[model samples]
Target: MAKQSTKNKLDTSALRPLLRYAKPHMWLFILSMVFAVITVATTLYAPILVGNAVDLIIAKGLVDFDGIINIIIKLSVTVTVTGIAQWLMSLCTNKITYCVVRDIRNDAFAKLQKLPLSYIDSHPHGDIISRIISDLEQVSDGLLMGFSQLFTGVCTIFGTLGFMLSINVKITLIVVILTPLSLFVARFIAKNTFKLFHQQSVARGDMTSLVEEMTGNQKVVTAFGYQEEAEEQFEEVNLKLQKVGLNATFFSSLTNPCTRFVNNLVYMAVGIVGALSVIKGVGFTVGNLSCFLTYANQYTKPFNEISGVITELQSAFASAKRVFEVIDETEEIPDSSNATVLTSVDGTLDVDNVSFSYVPDVKLIENFNLHVKSGQRTAIVGPTGCGKTTMINLLMRFYDTDSGEIRISGEPIKDCTRDSMRSMYGMVLQETWLKTGTIRENLCYGKPDASEEEMIAAAKSAHCHGFIKRLPKGYDTVISDSYSTISAGQKQLLCIARVMLSLPPMLILDEATSSIDTRTEILVQRAFEKMMQGRTSFIIAHRLSTIKNADTIIVMDSGHIVEQGSHDELMAKNGFYADLYNSQFAVT
Candidate 1:
């Protein structure tokens, strides 16, 4: 849902959003341009002074110490002022570029929070990371360099044209004629290289995705002895990246030398024209002829620079487009204008005639109905792809149902504020996620003001306190993906302790004890019994030992509840439920 197919071309639409982002910094941008103009205006004087120095030498021999000294002083002062202005200009440009990038990054990340779960499920993690990090860095850094050159190059072009025309209109016409050739060369090369850069960008994302996937599943790769296969896969993606990168850079690199060649031709024309004018005596002083020659060189230099700016700007535009693509995706369905805020959840829930399908043609759940009394343990057991997880997702409102309504405390959940609804539930999923932080900090994430006593008590109950206290820094030790000083089972125990610390009115424990050893599982189950009291709890477990004593057991198959009862009731019936139980335990 997030990825969109775009034609291979330079789309100016990406720049519109960038211009909008820049609007807040409009005055700052203008001030930067002012400094740029000052720099270029001062630089334009050096050539004129050089021409005057030449005139002085010819008019008063080469021994005019006073005239030479004065010209040298003026040249030095001009260069100093120009350098100061250039420095100021760079400061303002960097400020604008980075600020704009910061806003873009913020919006892109915020967009991810609002995007549908399906969008995240469908896209690769590394591709999304590339768009957020690498692509944005490219856009900002490239624009910084490209805009700096463009601002100065443009001013130099117009400023040089004015100086040349003032010196001699006929000589100025020489540049006006040859300048078109340089622009033509630039446009032709840019057109070819723009698409190549875009292709290279896509290839870079592909390479990142492959590497991330391989790294994340390293254990599986090694166990399967897939090293050679993984390396071959990487080489395929790396080769594609190399090919496109070479082509894009190859074409982009051609612009400078090609434009310079045309510029050199313009310079030769000016030299010839000035010498002819000097010979023909068209009332042009040697100083004026020399000034015209210098102006011609200055004029042609911006053309070469502008060409390079065009190449860099294309990469910036391509990255900007990728970033804007994410920002522009349709946001999650908004809460109601006057949404109800759930409070004091009673744990009562009713699923009425609910139907859902990930794909329109393949219905996963149809006309599903269920109800659980307040403060009861409801267990859902099902085979893979039997919509057990989907039901949990609906209960959490991570996804909306296609039809019918889900209610909590006899009020429709759709009308409740999602934040308030979610705040009522404490979830410990099968997958454990812990950001880089101390154990105490991770425990207090859902309840920032939790007391130290509450944290230690919950850790003790969840059978995690013993292991945590053994760590180097105890509760203060920092943990991360790379710096995991704990085992997987220990990590799961921490997750349970986190939920125990918060102590919400409702709970979701999806295979929460799967990682713990058999001995640890028994202790955790005692903690769960205490935690589940006076609160609604939903548990999805593959091991029947944990849920055998649940207040209600629901068996789901083919998107429908096939059998549901207490352990004794289902076993007495001796139907599908008895058969399923016997299959798991009746080993030959």
Candidate 2:
């Protein structure tokens, strides 16, 4: 019902946002309009020269040969000038169309970077990508069509109307009186088609998202024998797109034919009226009637073209709305004017009575409190959905606590600049990410200016050196974040190497070793243990055996800390921690 109401409220107001992007290229648009005027002026004037040539050749022997030749020369000049002006007009419009869309794409991508993690978490990744890429492309096509046809169409209509009025006002009035019928037909079709076009745009985005998800994880789909089910899902979304797209195309297609029918009626009426005036000897002549007929066609032709422009504009506006939605979303909270920049972080952290939830009504974490001294290794263990990762999010300031204060190195995190605060910690998550670049580039991502020796040393320490050397190009081999070119374990090892390259004052390993094999995990664990010395570390682990030597072990359940102590002390108590540890290694 809400969507129905939104469709019903479609108006020209949504196009206002696109004007902001086009403003910088306003001069080019104005130049195109100027060229359009020259094109129209020359095009309309050529008919007058033709009418004069017809007047010169009165009757067989009464023809004035020299006058006919002069009119022909003037006609040739007008045609040449019109061609040049039209070409110039097209060139300017092309530049304006491409430049405006380019600016819009840049702004949309920059906005994506600034949005809060909650927004990214809630929305489908494919849909966001569609708005950025596919929707913007639609806007470009619409702008191009509008520029090429709309400006010249409007100018030609008015220019031809003036020429017709000068020839015979009575016949011009007949053309003007019937003009509204064409407009009415175009408007009726365009109004109904806008809703269908908008629906088509949304369906296309959904299809793109589904395809991205299925294809990116085809291995999982195949492993689970979900191919048939995936095909059914694709068919459902594809059918919805097909339905709306067909309806939109069907109605928009009616604009050209229906307007042309009305326009033809107007043309025939002018031809009859002008021919009768010439016959009755009411001051109209054969040449005047001929010129009026041409003017009449020129006048109504724009209605047909303009109607087509209206249809394309409707689709463009729908796409623009989607792209603007991303740009207008609320961004992450900005830093205060006097936000501190901590150059020397001691890695001390304090979570005081913190509470948070992704949704307002359903609480995930409440009154969560923890304190860690500088250089202490803290291991956070919990069952699935126990807010362990949420704690890390809070520490990294990816999402702020709803009702508490989190201080880093004794200063409130809210008062610190986000870049400086985030720079204090090097993070590696269970789900690895590596950009499309060389191995050395991925390792040096956290520290761009690191020496080659430092990069190889980190890779060696992470036990990925063997694989790195075996690759065709060693450190120069290119890789993508898709994890297609390399094994997941290799990707994880590269991520570990990334953190080691930076060696920030603090570290976060959230199931960081889950992808690697046991032998490699043991070797990486040793590297991490060595790296954690004298630096504060937060390890979110599921494998109990991996974090046995952590300085502090925090066991959590349902967003609350149930037990916390050293490994020996927690085992002695035999409480929640003991049961969790024993359950993992329990006998059948």
Instruction: Please report the TM-score between candidate 2 and the true structure.
Output: 0.97
Write candidate 1's Cα lDDT for 218-286 as tens digits: 999999999999999999999999999998999999998999899889989988888988889898778
What's the lDDT for residue 422 in model 1?
A: 88
TM-score of each: 0.97, 0.97
For residues 482-536, write the lDDT of model 2, one tens digit per residue.
7556898999999999999999999999999999999888899889989999999
N/CA/C clash count, model 2: 0
Model 1 bad stretches (over 4 Å): 1-10, 59-62
**Model 1 accuracy (lDDT, Cα):** 0.88
Residue pair clashes in candidate 1: none
